[model samples]
Each structure stands twice: as C-alpha cells, then as structure tokens.
Target: MKKVLFAMALALAQTAWADGGMDILKSQCSSCHNLTGPAPQTLKELWARKGPDLFYAGNKYRKEWLVQWLQNPTRIRPAGEFYEDHIKPGEKHDEIDPATLKPHVSLSKDDAQAVADALMTLKPKSDLIAKEKIEEGTISKSMGEMVFDKFLGCMACHRIEPDYGGLSGPELYTAGDRLQPEYIASYIRSPQAWDPKIWMPNKHVSDMNIQKLVHYLEALSQENKNGK
Candidate 1:
C-alpha cells in the first residue's frame, strides 16, 4: 500500500509539471492570451477587447526579456497601440508597475525556466534555408520584383514613392539602402523582441521566403539612392 501510494503521488506530480506553459497561461495569462494564433474577439464588431497575438511568441522574445516583463508589466508604448492601458504610467514611455503586475502565483526559479522554454517554442509557419549571401550578380531584376510585390508581402505594409499599404507602422520604402541584409532578415524573423508593443503581425513566412525578401530589400537600396 505504501509503495502504491508513493507511485500515485509521483504520477500526479509529473502530470502537474507536464506543461508549464499551460499552467502559466491558465493560471495567470489565459484570461488575456490565446495559445494559438491571434486572440478571437468575436464580440462587438467595433469595440471588442482582444489580446496581443502570441502565435509567434517564441520568435519574438529573448528569454531574459520575457521573464523581466512577466514579473513586472511595463508600458512599452506610452499612448497605447492594440490592448488596454493595463500598466500605463504617467508620461513615461516605458514604466513597470510592480504592485499591479505582481505574479498571480509564486513562480519558483525552476517554474519560470519551464514556462519560458515552452513559450519560446511557438514559431510561425515556416521552413527556412540557412545559406550564405546569394551571389550579388546572380539575381535578375524581374525575380526581385516578384519577391517584393508578391511573395513576402512587403508591399502590404510599406509604400514606395507612389503609394502602398497602411501608415499605422513605420515606413520601409528605403529599407534596403538604410539597413544591412542580415539585420533585415533578423528583424523579419522577430520584430517583437525589438519592441514589445509592435504593431506589425508576424506573417510567419518560410525561411526561403525570408531570404528572398532580404535579397530584394538589399536590391531596393540601390534604387533608393538613384531615386533620391
């Protein structure tokens, strides 16, 4: 009876620790977050409160940054972009309110580690190819055009000298000239890590798509200079 009881206890304990992510989300975050893609706010068509998308949660954050932000919620944007002003502070751009943002349940160091690991594993839809820079002279002008206009969806968010998508976010017409190829690639892979309150959604394109986009962006750099 004693041995059987011990085994039962061990089984229960393991089950409890199985998915630290589910625990954290259910215990403290599920009220505002969704495990899958963007939160579904199917209520009032005009004014329903939906949470920030955590579909690409893993790609968007550094583990250290995630822990710090979780323990103490801070206002990454002073004016607010998508969500409510849960942790807004004065006129300051970034501020954390410890009292209001305290952990709902105590997270031991191990628990915190487990939670972070689970969160970081969620990536966008993608199959990437890690390769060296394509031959500068290898790409033709027509191929680059297709990449920018169609495959990568660059035209959706940014405008050229003529016109383009919404102006809610930063302009990227001159991206190629202004930014390095690798930096551009990294930014596409994870924009949220750069800023917690990013307005752009992670499109989660494949690695091949990412590389094509980078190459095209670099090509655009030359066009930008000549246009100016």
Candidate 2:
C-alpha cells in the first residue's frame, strides 16, 4: 500500500511539472506557429516555409503522438509541403535537431500537462462550419471518389481502402465520417489555412470545387451510413 501511494505521488508530481512545460514550447515554437485562427499570410503564402497549426491541437492529435513528435519530428510530412515542389526545383525539409530538442523539450512532468492543457484550449470560431445534412445521391458519391483518387490526388499518399495510395499521409479511409464538410472544403482549398506546413499536396482546389470534394469526403467514415 505504501509503495503504491508513493508511486501515485510521484506520478502526480511529474504531471504537475509537465503541465508547466508550456513555457518552453511557447518560447521555442510560437515563432513558427499559431495556436488558433486563419494562418498568417507570410506563412500561409510561403508554400515552402510553414508549420503546423496547433489551434485544434487538442482535437487533431493524440497526446502520445504529440509527445513523440515533440521529442523527434521526422517524416511526419513525407512531402516537404503540399505545394513545396511548386516553389523550388527540389524538395526542402526542416526538423528540430534531436540533441537540441531533447533538453529544450524537457518539462517538469507536471508542466507538460499544463502546457498540453493550455494548447488544447485553442479552439477556432469556425470549429464546425455547418451541421446540417445535404441531399445524398450517386453523382456526389462517384465524383467524390474520383476527385479523391484522381482530381486532387489525395490517393497518392493517403490509404483509403485495399490500398488507394502510399503510406505517406494519414489514413483517410474514414475521412468522410471523421471530418466536417466545411473543414474539408477549407482544408482542400488551402491546407496552409489550417497548417502552415501540412504534407497534403496543394492542387489549388477552388472554393466551389472544394465544397463538392468535401461533400464526398464527409461520406467516407463508418459512422455516416446515410452520408447525407
């Protein structure tokens, strides 16, 4: 009983220290990132030099993923940027040096949680563009599939099913269900709007086309049976 109690106390102390670790992140990371809102123009337009938006950090990433990424950010982005190739002749990439990041990344275990807590609270006003359902039909379904696989080339890196594409991007077999139509449209139109440097390709999808594509994506998850 004493041993268990002591372990619990140690765990609590670590969490407290981790929670306070936000200062380190703020000092080192904020220069390249925004906690919320539409991305900055300099970063948004750079195409090559950009960073991930942590506005919806809480919702988008698992805690473990964030910790591991902070410790060592590697090929999380297989492609330099969705539109990196357009800016330069060859792909360019950057990452925090493991040696430098190790010391800088450290936090009083308690501070880590606090930092995560603070970051998790960065919610965007446009959280859900809309909540209503649209008419479902064959055209939307077929076109959505084609758009995902060919038009936008989302299949190039994202795995949709029996093997839609490569393993570079996250699995989107359930994007139709997981993502909101509005969010999808916004992201497709400009991934930088959400994250300065996302791995998805930048085909420069237009707003109207983006909407249509998003409709298709919203229908993919197992949760949305009707996909309306």
Candidate 3:
C-alpha cells in the first residue's frame, strides 16, 4: 500500500512539473529558442538565428547540467551563436569587449528545474545518437588532441585550451564537463543531422578517431577540474 501511494504521488508531482515547465518555456524561452525544428538550412537563415536550436536539448544535455546551468547561466559560444553578428571587421580575435557580450537569462532554482524538465522533453531522433558510446579513458590524451587540432582542424574554429585556438565556435576546454558524451560524438560525426545550417562541417573521420576525440574532451575536462 505504501509503495502504491508513493508511486501515485510521484506521478502527480511529475505531471504538475511537466505542465509548469511547459508554461515557463512558452512564456520565457519561445522567443529565443526554437522548440520545434527542421533547423535552419541555409547560411543566411543560420545567420539570422539568434540562438542555438533547443529542439534536441533532451538528447544534447544532461538533466543535472541543464538544471545548474539554468540557474547560473554563462556564455557557451565564444563568438555569438552567429559569428558574423558579434565579430567586427577590423578587431583582432582577442580584442572582443567582454562588456558588449549579452548575458544569458538566469532563473531561480524552482524555475530552473521546471525549465530543465521541459527542455529535457525535447528529444531528437534516437537513432542519430544510439550508436555513439565513449569508453572513458580509452584514448591517449595526445592522440585525441592530435585528432582534434591537426587531423580535423577543429582548432580553426573552436577553443580547446585557454588562450589558444580560434574564437568563432564554443570553447571546448570545458566541453567534456558541459556536454554529454553522446552529444559530442554525434554532433561531431554529423552536425547536419542536428542542424542543417550549422557551420560545423562533416569531417568524415573514422569512428575510432571520433571516439578518441570524445575521450580527449573528457580527459581535458577532468584535468581542468583537478587543476582548479
């Protein structure tokens, strides 16, 4: 009887949360994020987008990470989501004015939890991520770094280490800590599947190299945590 009552209570609580979360998303997030997609299909359409599409948030993010990030929002993209909008013509890469950057909207703990619940409901195609699995610590750090920087030329757009790499994409120094392993692998493998107009091109690397890249990111994130 006790177990039955507990289960019933949990169901009711979850339903209440789901409803509240949807309400919050509609009121607060719909303006910036596209909850429904067929992501942008052209460079012009992509540049017009104001934020990254969140239609795949359930597949892309960990629930705990989303909850915490919602409460204490930070910049993920080094350049704005559309680089053309943020980077000026003559300024050097490091010369971006921090003061000019717009901060993400933060939420209270309760609201953040509600919002995360809603975001977590936005799953993309399951098959797109099902095959990706990162066996932690399997790849040597040097090999993974080599694949990321030289073999793939990812460094041309993304920042892997502090004060290093380009600024057009998101900083990857904390990617292992911030992103799901499946998301990292899946996104790298076929970015177009997630966002047709996203700037990240398909590299057609071997699956082994993809696994190495994920491991590398995890190792880098762990090192950063320990160093701090």
Candidate 4:
C-alpha cells in the first residue's frame, strides 16, 4: 500500500514538472523556437524560420549539452538564425553584420533542466536517426580537417573555431558536444533529409569520410573543453 501511494505521488510530481516546463516554453520560447514541426517544405518556409526546429531534439542533441547551453546561451549560427537578414555584401565576400545580430536569452538552471527534459521528449521521426551509424576509433586531426575543408568544402559555411571559418552556417566547433554523433553523420550525409531547403548541399559523403568527420568533431570538442 505504501509503495503504491509513493508511486502515484511520484507520477503526479513528474506530470507537474512536465507541465511547468511546457508552460515556460510556450511563454518564453515559442516566438523564436519551433517546439514542434514538420521541417520547412519550401525555400519560402525555410526563409521564414526564426530558429532551429526542436521537434527532433531528442534525436539530434545530447541532453547534458542542451541543459548547459540553455542556461548559458551562445550564438550557434554565425550569421544569426536568419542568414538573409544579417548578411552583407563585402568587397571580397559576403559577411554577417555583427551589429544586426542579437544574443539568445539564457534560462535559469532549474528552468534549463526542466526545458531540456521537455525537449528531450520530442523525438518525432526517430526512425531517421535510428538509421545512422556512428563510427568508433580515432581520427587524425590533419587528415580529418583535409576532408572537412578541401574535400567537402565544409569550412566554406561552418566555423571550426570561435573566430575561424565562414558566416553562413551553424558554428561546428562545438558540434561534438552539441549534437549526437549519429545526427552529425546523418546530417552531413544528406542535409536535405534534415532540412528540405537548407543551403547545405546534399554531399552524399561516403561512409568512411562521414565516420572520419564525426571522430574529428568529437576530437575538436574535447580540445575545446581542454581550452586548447
């Protein structure tokens, strides 16, 4: 009898916690975030997107990273969420105007935890994630970089370091920490499957190259953690 009562109480508490988290998201994050989604179907819808879609957050992100990032938010996309808004034509190349960008709002520790918990519950189309395979073992930094830069031209859009690389895509210096390995491989393999009209091309990278890049990102994250 006591065990039954305790179980019911625990369930009720969890329900309340989930409700609180949803309330916070609806009030504070709904305007800029897509808590639910069918990813944009056209360039127009893609252009209208204000933030990265979170419907598949459970499959795309690591929970610990989400909790920490929510508490201490940082810019993920160098050109801001909407590239068309912040980009400017320069003498040599197009640049993101720093002045036009705004910082993401940070959540309190408790709120971050709650929100992370809620976000992790949203894993629609998880079958897509299930199909991805993460390669094990180490990758040589130089070789991996060669694939990322010269071979694939990834550095053309993504930043490999805080002050390095391009302005059009999400900074990938922290991709290892920010995303699940399978997601990283899957997204790189066919970006269109993830975001239909995204600027990222469908590279159809080979299995060997994908694994190499995943290992590289993991290594990069570790290096950043060590402040190297």
Best candidate per TM-score, number?
Answer: 4
lDDT of 3 at 159: 79
- Cα deviation at 161, candidate 1, in Å, is 27
Clashing residue pairs in candidate 3 are none
- What order do candidates take by TM-score, descending? 4, 3, 2, 1
Residue-by-residue lDDT tens digits, candidate 3, 90-207: 5544445455579998999998898888888888766787978777557677887788888889999887777677778888888887888998998898888888867778999788
**Could you give candidate 2's per-residue lDDT for residues 101-210 as a string of tens digits?**
22233444444556666565555634443432334433356777787777767776776553345444555655554444555555666665565545566798765566
Total clashing pairs in model 2: 26
lDDT of 1 at 2: 100
Error of 2 at 41 (Å): 3.4
lDDT of candidate 2 vs native?
Answer: 0.54
Q: Tell me the lDDT of candidate 4.
A: 0.88
Query: How many angstroms is residue 181 displaced in model 3 relative to the true structure, after the best TM-score fit?
Result: 1.0
Q: Give the residue spans of candidate 4 off by over 4 A.
A: none
Each candidate: RMSD: 12.2, 9.3, 1.9, 1.4
Best by lDDT: 4
The residue-by-residue lDDT of candidate 4 on 164-225, one tens digit each, is 99888999989999999989988988888888889998888998998899999999989988
Error in Å for residue 126 of model 4:
1.0
| Local accuracy by lDDT, each model | 0.54, 0.54, 0.82, 0.88
Give the lowest summed-lDDT range of ten residues in model 1. 75-84
Error of 2 at 18 (Å): 7.6
